[model samples]
Target: MAGVAGNQPLYICRNCKNPIALRSDLLSKAFIGKYGPAYMFSHAMNIIAGQKEDRKLITGAYSVADIYCCNCGEILGWKYLRAYEMQQKSKEGKFIIETAKIAKEY
Candidate 1:
């Protein structure tokens, strides 16, 4: 069955831990034929979490914190993928330590 984004539940950003409203324009354009299952499954069941550098440890420190909604300031999920460390880990370590696709909205 095709999932409708309009009728689907949207969670806030997991990073900031704030509420985020669905981006209507992006959502509408994302789905196919009004409301597509693939698009809804991808968005509704997906959470984009990003990590940032902490400039206070004297050394580079990254927190597994930060989840922001594209539409609004809300946290959806937390991840360890920092833009600086995105490609700094080995294959096994990357898989074991890093989280590519984190958890979903509850």
Candidate 2:
């Protein structure tokens, strides 16, 4: 889902219409918990950094912070795979945002 003008589409919070990310940055689709379908983003904008949380995945991973919408304080997503401190070869964090919570601006 590209954006208007045939460029990167804007991913905005459905509750407040605040910009969250761009479709071009989308990495993959995932279904987690009861949140339904969500998309992984290489990067996200306008996010309020929160606390770090632990996750049990494979060898386990942690989120750098619980991301929230800067405008409405809504839980946008999380930045995960923050094992850079242990494994230098590990990639940086990835942003995972629920597709239901946001809309594509096109």
Largest lDDT belongs to which candidate? Answer: 2
Q: List, residue by residue over 2-99, the lDDT tens digit for candidate 2.
A: 43325766889999988888778887875352366778788888888787765654434654577889999988767774663475224356777877
Q: Which stretches of candidate 1 lie over 4 Å from their true place?
A: 1-51, 55-65, 82-106
Please list the residue runs of candidate 2 whose C-alpha ends up more than 4 Å from where it truly belongs after superposition.
1-7, 31-34, 57-59, 84-91
Task: Give all TM-scores, in the order shown.
Answer: 0.24, 0.76
Q: How far is candidate 1 from the true structure (C-alpha RMSD, Å)?
A: 13.3
On the 0 to 100 scale, the lDDT of residue 36 in model 2 is: 67
Give the C-alpha lDDT of model 1.
0.31
